[model samples]
Target chain A: MLAFVITTVLCFITYLLLTTGSGTLGLWSLEEILVGAILSLIVGSLARTIFVKDNFRMLNPVRWIIFIAYVIGPFFVAMAKANVDVAYRVITGKINPGIVKISPDLKTDFGITMLANSITLTPGTLSVDVDEDKNDLYVHWINVKKKALEKKPVNYRYVCGKFPNWIRRIAE
Target chain B: MIFNLIIYILLAIGVFFNLLAGVGLLRFPDVYTRLHAGTKCTTFGSIFICGSVILIGLRMWYTGSTDGSVLAIHTIFALVAILLTNPTGAHAIARAAHRSGVAPVRAVVDDLQNNTLKKEEEK
Candidate 1:
């Protein structure tokens, strides 16, 4: 029931965000509100299990703040650098492409997922696969650094600088 | 006037990055590298484009237009959606390509394949 309510509320918020300025009731109309409520409830009930899962640690507001900080800070900077790196490669056609594996030591599926998504967006590395048993990630690196492979399983820092720590603080 | 200049600059950056994404897609040699181009560039480009829209909306709201509030909020949501889905989609494509026996062209190393081989041998 808690999960149901949580999912419903989240869905409703999303609906409201989408339907903003549709009515005079402070950016939402009575009809819009009513429709949104009903739709979100239905969608929420159906999606509660999948959406909420067993771990609700993400519901903590502090984690949300950290996530926002991460997006604005290191994440944004890395994305800019990633673009420039890609642009350089695109123009000069220089690449040392390879697939390397790294164990971020993240325990939860959510953390791994977040890390993978962040890795994809932030650098020349794209997450290619996962080792579910050990929670290992296979990363497609545009530039394979020799220092990164000086040790086995590689290092998360070399692939995604300081991201694992940030994700750990937020997700774990 | 200053806002217009900022918006123009943001739009130019956004368009330039998006165009880079397209060029990278064509210029890269393999599925993984192309995805590295297609996904990251577009995601970064969209951020700038949406940032410009959000700025416009904020300016309008500052000028006392209620509709601008909705516009800015909605644009933020769109940006969040792109941020969430784009990378996941890229991951899916990369995973599928790897699993379907497509090798990374000119790859100096392939640990994922070695892992798979080890798993197969273990079984």
Candidate 2:
């Protein structure tokens, strides 16, 4: 299947990256390549379903590029801002922490997982739980802004900016 | 000299954030908040630290050291491993803590139980 091939290729690439400069052929030896190929095939066949469920969209090079951009661009910027915010909170002891729910409305499992991981990775917010049936995320927010509650639909911008949009682009 | 200076700066930022993470872990009130400090700060800090090492490797490679390329690439793999695992570990911890009935301090709402109840009723 497509999933099996993609997982094999990915596992092999990871193997190659991990074993760089170990052999003679620029980065890998002929023997190492053979070993890696055999290992990758074995692992790929066993773990293909875990990586890709029913869709191969995630295997697209475009999605990977978008994911890289997501990491280096907005995610990095947000992380910096969050580090500052958390550092300030740690210093001044001025934090109003609480849990709140947000509905990102992501359908796919990968999209939901990506959004949850992003939320957990960023400072000031931890994704405490997910409502699998309704696709709602319950996030523990460090500084739960008052406006977030009063807004027409609870501004998620207060928690994570553009994260859902990027998840949509990359995973959805 | 400039490259070294840049690498130093990156390393400094990484160390500073990691130090802040440690401080936050000590100062934060509850388990959930401490998890926040423990996970995100370290992850962000490690990314920069590994990134600086990658930079060093690239510089060496550019200077005709073949090992430099290998060093950089391996550091990248380590970075990738950290990035992939850290958040997932945090998620697992948070979920476990919640499931075990550890509530956030001063939390205004607890919808998790209510949602579960709703799902049960619907079923």
Candidate 3:
């Protein structure tokens, strides 16, 4: 029931966001609202099982606020630096590439997924595969660091700086 | 005038990074590196481009054009979609490439290869 409601609301929001400026009826026409509600209901019912993933923690308003802050704050700075790093590597043509595994110790699939995606977009790393049972990520690091690999599993910091910690706050 | 100036600067930086992505794509050695170029650079570049559009919309809204809010909001939604989907798609591609035995060129190490071999043996 919760899943259904969440999905319905999310779908309706997406529909509304897409169809803005359509009419003067409070930024939507009566027809648009009716069509959106009916469409969202259909989508909501179909995706209810998959949409929520048996997790209600993500629906927390506090997590959403943290997520926005992370995006606007550290995440944006890291991305800008990543672009400059990539630009430097492109110009220098000096790369020591390798795939190394790291255990992030995240309990949930969402956390692992978020970490992997963050690694992929950040400096010097691309997520290539996962060890699902162990919750380990196999990252292709553009510049392999000797210090990180001294451990059994490479440290996440050498690949992504403080991202898993932030994701733990937001997702875990 | 100031808003247009800001928009122009954003557009310039966005275009430069996008073109640099193209250059990196052509120069990179292998699949994963190519993805680094194709995905990250484009995402960064698109942020600036979409941001400029959002700024334009904001300026218009402040100047009493009601349509501006819709324009800005919709562009933001599009930007969010790109941010969410681009890296996921690249991850899929990287996984597929590794699974198909397309090895990273001149790699110093490959932990995924061991996992694949172990999985294959189990199968």
By TM-score, the best candidate is: 3
On DockQ, the candidate that comes out on top is 1
Highest-lDDT candidate:
1
Task: List, residue by residue over B13-72, the lDDT tens digit for candidate 2.
Answer: 899989999999999999888888888899889988998999999998889877887999
Clashing pairs in 3: none
Docking class of 2: medium
lDDT of 1 by residue, B13-57 (tens): 999999999999999999999999999999999999999999999
lDDT tens digits, residue span A20-92, model 2:
7776798678888999999999999999889878877876789899999999898888788778888888899
Report how far residue A53 has shifted in candidate 2, in Å: 1.1
Clashing pairs in 1: none
Candidate 2 lDDT for residue A171: 86
Whole-model Cα lDDT of every candidate shown, in order: 0.92, 0.85, 0.90
Residue range A9-43, candidate 1, lDDT tens digits: 99999898888878789888999999999999999
Every model's TM-score on chain B = 0.93, 0.90, 0.97
lDDT of candidate 2 at residue A111, scale 0 to 100: 90
After aligning candidate 1 to the native by TM-score, how far in Å is the CA of B57 from where it should be? 2.6
Give the worst 10-residue stretch by lDDT in candidate 1 chain A: A18-27
